[model samples]
Target: MAGIPHYYLYGEPGAGVDRDLLHIEPVRDRSGPNDWRIRPHAHPDHMQVMLVADGGGTIRMEDRTLAVPSPGVLVIPAGIVHQIDFDPGTDGHVITAALPCLAAAGAQDPALGRAAGQAAAYPLDGSGVDVAAAIEAFRSLQREFLWAAPGRRAAIIAQFSRILVLILRLSLIHRAPAIGAADHDLLVRYRALVEAQFRSHHPPAHYAALLAVTPARLNAACKARAGRTASDILHDRLVVEAKRYLIYTESSVAQVAHLTGFEDPAYFNRFFTRRVGCAPGAFRRQAAES
Candidate 1:
């Protein structure tokens, strides 16, 4: 596939330079002008947290599309290819900040750091979270971001950090079976390896060897942290990459299979169809028509 668009902000080309950058604006400011649709794009060096205070829609991340729950929050990590389609007149706030800013904020709380590092959506209604406190934090962040008052930077970071804490609380409530720190660390390492070597078609066992762990241990860690087997994680990464090529490129099915590390196009076809419940070509066509 051709290079996916990378922007500091959705339509703005080029990377951001400000290490302390923290931008907050109403969601409609950008989404409204574009008909409430944010096309597939990536931010190379920044992360975003969005609060959906009003209407909602769907978010397309890699190969999956998830409904955006209103009165919710979305944490999007840097370098994820995503698209957002919002219902008209959706009102909310989107906070875009440099990765360093988040890292610094998360330094004191590892859970907060972990929560902000992943892409997740949480609905505020009936979740037992302090929704009012979270909303007020967003409002406070917007005010601090808009002004040049003394200690503005500190105030912005403090408010944004509060939001992250709230998100972490919600995530814990919705999380799968809790995993120990070692297991979580192993899962993170495994995911990083998959991101680097997925196109090589390495088996999960190969990854386990590289991590100096047995296959059983690797699988156990992945299951505990991600609710998936080690093999499932590798296969899911492959499927996500295949979907990206199919949707964003003009490559034929055979070429896509080859690009995704399958020497036998027929095998790739079967694998994709079984996992996605549709042939690659059919999925592409459906994506285009939608």
Candidate 2:
């Protein structure tokens, strides 16, 4: 871990590695317009779980975008390209964790499948209240663990498991029985590809070449099904990961710049502030204090 690069740690065993027994959960309500409408992006090795507390919108993936109504939740697996646009009038909470944590929770645990593979991505039908309750409890525990104790990792995992199970109980969408398995598989694969490559090569053409499809064709599929352009998804994906690295790692701004594929750390700093409303270091300092 000491010698291996962090990029290789994408879902690997090192810093930010997924934990079966440790989860840092957050809770926010009416938090103003912040971290909402997360850009399209992918996690090379982590999965994200989110619940819609109010309103309705759409969630775009590599191959398809699904309509999301309030009282719903979602599980996004690692290595997928996707983005969420909350209903302009809606507010919600999101829980993101590494996939290794999901897997470590035994495959048989309903939450694992609800958050690990295809069956797990879209789980919210009308469970917003429950999701909110679980998240509230999770957040409470997180705050307590942070301020009061040093060894509550076990308790955190147990509580998080309850949250996942609540998410899994929501009724799933019944997509047509006609969508061929191959197409479904392709959709999943395309998302995974975007997750792994969005940071480096962002053009749809580059991705189409990897997928062995024409850029135009890929664009059509993404637009028609996912409700957005491939370029949009690609850029959003890159930015989110960049934000995570900037906020969570102790690496210097220059180093975060390099890790995010920026040729110049100064330019990266400018870009980060422009989009995020603050300089990378400033945001890091503020987040640390919070």
Predicted candidate 1 versus true structure: per-residue lDDT over 143-177, tens digit per residue: 98878898876788888889889879888876623
- Please, what is the whole-model Cα lDDT of each candidate in the order they appear? 0.80, 0.56
Q: What is the lDDT of residue 24 in candidate 1?
A: 85
Listed in order, each prediction's TM-score against the native is 0.61, 0.46
Candidate 2: count of backbone clashes, pairs at least 3 residues apart or interchain: 6
Clashing pairs in model 2, backbone N/Cα/C closer than 3 A: 40-237, 41-237, 73-124, 79-192, 80-191, 114-120
Angstrom error at residue 217, model 1: 24
The weakest ten consecutive residues by lDDT in model 2 span 1-10
Deviation in Å, model 1, residue 77 alpha carbon: 0.7
lDDT for each residue of candidate 2 in 1-290, tens digit (9 for 90 to 100): 11212221222343533332244433233223444464555554355566555676777765677776556566665445665666666655555565444544434564344334542334344434455575465556556446646545455555566666654554333332221134334445566588667668567888888888888877765554344567766765555667667655778888878887888888888877876688888888876785
Candidate 2 off by > 4 Å: 1-35, 88-90, 107-111, 119-150, 171-290
